[model samples]
Target chain A: MDAIAEKKPVAFNRWLPYWAVFQADVRQTLRSWVYLFWVLLSVLATVGYLLYRFGSYHEGGIVQTASVHVSQLLRWIVLGSAAIVCVLTAGSITSERGTMADSVLSRGISRYQYFLGKWHARLATVLGTFLTLGIATLISALFLLHEDLSLDGSLVALAVVAALLTTVITFGVTVSAVANSTVLGIAVLWSMLCAAGFLMSFLPPRYPSPDRTLERLPYILQGNYDLAGLAQFAGWSLLASGVAALFGLGYFSRRDV
Target chain B: MAENSSSNMVVETFKLTKIYQNRQIALNDVTLRLEPGCVLGLLGSNGAGKTTLLRLIIGLHRPTAGWAKVFGKFMTPNAAELRRRIGYIPTNPQFPRGMTPITYLDYMARLFGLPKDVRKPRLASLIRAVDLLRVSGDSIAGFSNGMTARLAVAASLINEPDLLIWDEPTHGLDPEARRSMLELIKTLSREKTLIVSSHNLSDIDEVCNHAAVLSHGQLIYCGSLQDLKGRMRRNHFELDLEGEQKAITKSTTAIRALPEFKVVTLKHRRLELYLQEEVGGAAALANVLMTLNDNKVTLVSIRSVGQQTEQAFLDLVEKEESRGFARIYQAEAA
Candidate 1:
């Protein structure tokens, strides 16, 4: 039998090689017209939301509380910006199956590295987009709406949004890895997101009461030294994202590309 | 497995087989061993499992039974080091739409862990080698089929892989491009082990020293090109006559009566003769001419006819088809 003993010792961090793929993917995402279109749409939506908020303030001739304005901005960022994230990530793997994987994978990059690279690259883009929108919204709220936003509440909300974006992007990556085509991956993700939204619409009021331990995980982990609803939301979001990422990696590694 | 463990061997497969989810037996009981520094031409018709075997060797598809080893290592999903020694170009290789040849190769180089200093000059030399220096900076999306093929070739060589697998490298090229590609392949074969799978017989004849022919997922022939040709060579000759039909008929009968001629057929003024295995070419020709001359027959022309590689390939495939084997087989039985 062959020696099989000359196997190169794996490096300390095996995933380090994935950085190259990540960088290439990031460049691809930036150059894509789809990303440009989504970025523009997000910006325009943010601007529209700001205009509507300013109009409400002007018409009522009263300054709304900072929490109300922050809540509205968070809703738009999560709903509107997350939609763009889904679209951007939905084709991350499927589009590359025929076009690039044959060449790239044959060069000795493992499926796990490729999947992880794409995952991290797309997550960076989505998170950057969310941060930019969040900052812009905060600046606009403080300057135009003239409300004193609480720093603690704003940070917690940002953390919650970050967790939510992570979950959506990971789920989108899973869909991308499983589907055979970009269109199919996008359609599947869109349908699932719609289904989740439909289901969430029926939740009862006060579903997570103040006394519930499940409602207090995110704040507990955020160094806020408190247990609250945002903490629980963050915990659940991380768990879902972790499970989706694992599933994507497992399926991608076993299936022929 | 023990017999195939030589360091010189670049690839080895033992009873490798692949069955699709739809019950299509893509490859069955394929046992092959390839040494370094040879161009292996993989020949077969459509659905003959040429691509399937190549994919299995490259670890793109898992074998349903048995396995393959590359660079003395069993192929696996995480065979990164093993795969680093190989470069593969798929049929009709496609790249991301916006990348130029330069950028694309650069990315590939990085994936192979080539440092920046080495990558720059290597990319430049490969671009010049493929004669793509002129358009190396242009987006590959706008390249023609020949240009894409050239880029694929260049990309495959970016890492200086020990083995290169090209699936129909010249399938869609124009005549000039095809010629250039063949020349490129010939040049690369000097230093690297190559597995070129193609349908064009002339291309194989031009560049390959050895060949493996597949039929219905079975390896019908695998050996040196010269050996394959030798196995299919025939002791045959064609004769043209310029005499009366009576004289021609008499000469044909005389030739058939000779023990040297195993089979003879006459059509109009032309005669085809197959010499007995024991008869040498020179002696057989002399005997036929002497017989014709004695029969008052005027011989217009005579030429020996040997089977070409294409003829041999067709004959092998036709023979396999006539056997009428089922398309699917049990994994263990295969």
Candidate 2:
């Protein structure tokens, strides 16, 4: 078969949008029974807890203890299962690779664009899930804790912090892609998070009152509520989440398929 | 490259090489050029590096050396644009399970940013082209392997990619389905460059104008099918005669006679002959006919070789094996 002329590269263009990719990823994620189960169960649990602890209505007699406690518990829940998002992203790539999806690579797009497109779609999914849980937790806390728990400026700062912390989700996704197994990826993500938490505790100049840290958490959850810690949270979140996203971006950029 | 400026070559790999982490060489300094509006058959046995070569071309995996470009740009530059220009169909395509072609195709179409107006017509056309219109709305869980293959093919075309790469596109199809898929590939090649990998020689013998045979990650041969057929050094011919023994002894020793045939049973009738490379096959046939005429032997029939070209191909594979490559000739035996 030697009659053909030498080969040359074909010109390609990138006209697709990030939103479309994100929409496709989310649709696929929603179709998963596991994700549906998590969404339904998380919502139900939040609803049941609110109903059992306090009636459907919020009254002035509520205490800050339960609100703060619930906020902390929800954060833990969100972070704990966040590894699943990574697993999902990683699984998508691995399964395609296993079946030799390189067929897709013959397309015009470069590896960088493919990886970014996928990363963008996956990140959007993580953000969407985070929002859903946030709404549920917010509604539950508002009902159980009532107006007795004031929404302070500190609360606004905390909300920002939560959003920033959630950037950790990107790290999980990246780890999932490079690591061999979903379990190992999740472990890597968890270990990294635990390490971060431990490092945060060791930071010199601990807050004057250790117990007050619990009381201060809800303010931190409320994003921009506390101007005092605003810079710290923003600085840390940007640096940490940005670095995390880069890790994923870097891993994905170099990966085949 | 210049003559077809507007009709640009879609997929191109220049001296591409892929060395697996375990040190297995998947492709060795492959330099291939696929022009627009043509179909190329990657004919090889399993583990012949067909898939590996495909992966490198598509940028699914990094090459150990050299580079590949799709739609005229290196894979790392403007990747999204590159993706927009090519379609890929892998054998045994997997879905997220329970996903219907409609959803999946729609998702892919959207990913390509095909507007609602464009997506509707494009999706409908692709589904019809692949003959999956009836089940486009059905879940993949219930689809057969052939159906999935069709869907994968259809999805790859959603963007009307200029280059299409399909690995074993008809691997598990029924004969009818295989024919339809091959025909579809032929139709696609009218406007797009298509590369298909498969071990079905007969299937390829029909659709492929250009082909390359891979053995142990190295291309043993690459060219047009006609050129390959033309490269054979010998032409075969069979002769039937009465008093075969007398004719066999009388014929010149320059021509090799088959000793395998039973002369006693034929009494006087038997088959025998050969055509050397320098002797025009037709001239050799004339000589044999003359010899038969002189010996008063009646001619039964004369025809060109029935399947010597195929046998010659097997012989080439054996030759390659003897030179150091592991032979997968058992696939032909199957």
Candidate 3:
């Protein structure tokens, strides 16, 4: 046999791994058993909650307001999916921990690209689910239930809940990247969620946190909320997510695969 | 540090150390330089840090105290371009679940940024090469250990890396799969710089010209295979004879009377012996043939069977362990 010639790395395009990661992770997230269960459960809960609202209003001889409709739509769909979302995002890093070493460590793939790809894929899932459920519930409340829910109120409520969901997903992914085990990541995320809620309750309502923003989501949707407080909360929440994202990226880059 | 980047060197580690979780000193102060072309056999017992060292060189695990350079650049976790030149087969590879070989290889090729045109043909060729053509469309979850290992081999070569670092490539393979893998390594050794870490010293003896033996996280021996064998002061021999049992029994006495020979065992015209340092088995075997002068006795096949590299490795590890005990003894005494 002739001597094997020495080889060089391919003149690789930098963005390939990032895009591949995003595409593969999107498939993985959508096909996961938990995600399938989540979709089914979310649809059932939203439909049930809508029917119950109509039944309650009819029985009490009271009209369902726009704020009530929007609030409960979120309560049933977004908040209901939060635990399953946490599970999906928390295992995002830990689940890949063993397999990724074979591919990511052996190639020209950046941790930044990998981290962002996974982050963006799960982020897409959260936003996509929220929008789909929000639109469906809005139509149901408007036509079928004859509830007085406004388009502006529904959109505003969906956007705020979307931002808050983004924060939760980002935090969950970061915790997964930082912790060594999926169990640990899930525990830390649940703790952070609880801590955020508990800590925000201690703060005055004028400068509301994201957790506080959710509590008064109805008032916020009705435009009775303080605009200055909403902006501050949005900025702080984004800054926190940004910091966590940077930390998770840096930590993951140095972590042993 | 300058010599590490000297183009001819494929891998270099200077005082490279790794202490995992502040408790296990997985690899300690291992310094070596591997030139291009030599297939280095990494021989170490379980937990001797073979995996740790390989991981360090590939930039999967960072060095705690020193550094490693692969292809002239310091290997870091984020050294994407440098890492692109390395093909690593991790121990018991856990491939992405729910993916067929075709999809997995496609994913791997894309990670290395191969274009659709280049990626398709390459995956096809590699699948054929590793004999995974039949299962190319099957999910990796259904693959046996042998199949998964073959897929991993294909994945490693996706980018045509300059250096191949394989950790226990045949750890769980059946004999057939193991033999095929060894044959593949032998073929690949003609061209690429490979570091194969395995406990199968016989396989190492077959394919590797250079050997590195690690004992308890320390480099006990590192040099050419000939040099490692040269350190052995005793020689081993095995022989088969075509003769009557009576003739063979009589010849054994004459063989034992020879000054240089020590008969280890003799049974049914077969013989095993060891010789003292220097004369080795060849000269001693000649003397034995001269002494077995019975016309009824004849040599069928005579092989100056040398001590396998396995023996050398065991001797090396045994010696290192004793020294370790000695040092601890002294420390306790102090």
- Alpha-carbon interface RMSD for all candidates, in angstroms: 3.3, 4.7, 1.7
What candidate 2 gets wrong by more than 4 Å, as runs, is A1-17, A55-66, A79-126, A145-147, A153-161, A206-215, A218-226, B1-11, B233-297, B302-309, B324-334
**lDDT tens digits, residue span B255-289, model 1:** 88888878999989889998887667788788889
Please compute DockQ, using alpha carbons, for every candidate against the native two-chain complex: 0.41, 0.36, 0.62
TM-score of each: 0.85, 0.79, 0.90
lDDT string for model 3 (A196-236, tens) is 87787788756666556677767755657565666677677
Candidate 1 regions off by >4 Å? A1-17, A59-62, A81-83, A194-228, B1-8, B233-236, B240-287, B295-307, B325-334
| A173-223 per-residue lDDT for model 2 (tens digits) | 566557766566667767876676666666565432222343455655543
Candidate 2 matches the true fold with a TM-score of 0.79
Error of 2 at B284 (Å): 6.7
Model 2 chain B worst lDDT window (10 residues): B258-267
Each model's lDDT = 0.80, 0.63, 0.81
- Candidate 2 lDDT tens digits, B89-147: 76667765556888777767766666677777778888887788888888878998888
Please say which candidate is ahead in TM-score: 1 or 2.
1
Clash count, one per candidate: 6, 43, 1
Provide the lDDT at B103 for model 1.
Answer: 90
